[model samples]
Target: MKAEILYEAISEINPKYIEEADMRVITKINPWKRFLVAAACLILCISLSIPALAATDNSFAYELLYTVSPELAQNLKPVRETCEDDGIKMEVVAASIEGDTVNILLAMQDMTGNRITASSDLMDSYSIHMPYDQTACCQLEKYDSETGIALWSITIDQAESKLKPGDKITFSVSEILSQKEHTEIKLDSIDVSNIIEATEFTVDPQIRGGAGNFDEDSMECKRLLLPEENGYKLCDGVILTGTGMVDGKLHIQCKYDDILNTDNHGYIYLKNSSGEVDEYYSSISFWADNKTDSYEEYIFDIPYDELAEFEIWGEFWTCNNAPIQGEWQVTFAISE
Candidate 1:
């Protein structure tokens, strides 16, 4: 065995090795110099768990966040950010592919020294969804342009797999050190973007519903989903309707004349002048005690774009109209 290699290996041993009686200074001895060093001190036999190329974490604990689907449009945003220090590695793999939804297999493991295991089969791995619609690519081969590899490797050169939308699967640590302590992982949030057909008409969905009850000078227009003062129905689709060509601002006049209200973010989506459906959070802000006698205003803004279809979504609670009111108006400013 290489003497220098053996020397280096000995240095990595825990401090306990130094106190052993009869053991001379490992002058030129290192574990890598001879596998026998491990065979002698540690008789544990670990098997070939995962593919040889994948790297596994050396530490026992890890954090993992798997984004289900990646938005594969022209404009892609950050799906999720992950970080690891204690010998952990992250893996991405393909889960499913249905129309536009792309599911991704995310895995975290103790990769101090071992192969990481990931699979395309949905039967065994866990995954998350993201907007990975490579539909904008003129050619199927352009996938590499979008991302060189489907799965991103946090530790080694090669990752387990590449992934697409709507796919399902479980990703796991194929091989890990038996001696590693504290083994586990976490999931964080994700970001997404859209694929645009036309540059001038991209579905800029995120900025929607931002500004609210500004200093009054920015207030522009107001209209209801229908002529009735009732708040817009979620699933059926109501428009913050009347506005300049730009998707500027949105306002809602709640007609629940009698109920106190607390606003929340809901599942709002968009359909541009182009017909593509884009979903975003409808940031609704309203007075908590809405029935306090003074008329309160609820404001939501849509991102500015030359094209869009504004819609509301997400969980809804019943609105009691004792201060019973009618027709609510939503409005926005026109952008040039």
Candidate 2:
């Protein structure tokens, strides 16, 4: 079957149901025979009730906000505005204004049966304008292949003087580009020379920690206090405390002696044994609740078996992506 024909069949079903069908189809057929199996699965899924699938609302923003802060979810306002052109649809699902920040959830779909997504590159292709002068961050939260739809979360930090309560901000997009025209840079082209500096370190295997709690008794925790010469300082006073594997994920912690400095920020990257970069997720911040020493933790989703063969790299940069002058790499190795 042609790719477009297969996509059309898949698009008839709901995105959520397509996930289970995708898994079953993948497991049942060989890699070369995936298209045939996908077509068969799509036919089976379409026979079911379309209204039942439509009843389930799988909004990524709804789930994320509810999970993190229910109060924020309660105050969210729906945005019924949508823009469509060139076989592409952009829907402004909802928006929430909290203090100095306004969060907007957008859903984009490719109606041309293409497997394109609202990736960062695609977002960069368009210009988003708000009512006020603000700094914005856009993250592609989720993508549904079945429907060729992608969900995005955009947060805008408005100046205190510019934004007030009961103010509705109007957002507009311009210069939208086709996804096919976007050129993706290969991973090999990433130049890291002088961008980061790294040193090798090991974590003892006997140490362990429960969910959300660090094992203080573990040797890993003790090593967090390594002397200045052995440890890497993320900034002038921010120290890379320790590295460890917690619950099959690579965990690295840092101590920020100077939390008041807003300019201090950094990022952590992972490289596998093959030199290819691995995708990892982390949340780093400068604030700590009622603690004398503020800390930041980076956790990479890596399997235990592959953790031993991986290396961790750290880079100190301003939040705006400006390079901080210094060597900033800390490699990791698991010691038996």
Number of the top-ranking candidate, with lDDT as the measure: 2
Regions more than 4 Å wrong, model 1: 1-60, 63-217, 221-263, 267-269, 276-284, 288-336
**Structural similarity to truth (TM-score) of each candidate:** 0.20, 0.35
Least accurate 10 contiguous residues by lDDT in model 2? 327-336
What lDDT tens digits, residue by residue, belong to model 2 across residues 89-201? 67666665555555666666667756344432232322333234465555455666666667665665566444444443434343232231211122232232312222433
Give the per-residue Cα lDDT of candidate 1 at 22. Answer: 25
Write candidate 1's Cα lDDT for 1-336 as tens digits.
875345345433433332252233212121112222323212111110112111334111111111211122211212222334345544331122322222222333334533222311111011111111121100001111122222322111112232333222222222221211111111011011221221121121111222223332232322212222333333221212211222334323222222222111222334444555543323222222333311222334445452223333222222221121111111111110
Question: For model 1, how many clashes?
Answer: 80
**Structural RMSD, model 2:** 21.1
Question: How good is model 2 by TM-score?
Answer: 0.35
In model 2, what is the error at residue 215, expressed in angstroms?
43
Extract clashing residue pairs from model 2: 197-328, 197-329, 198-329
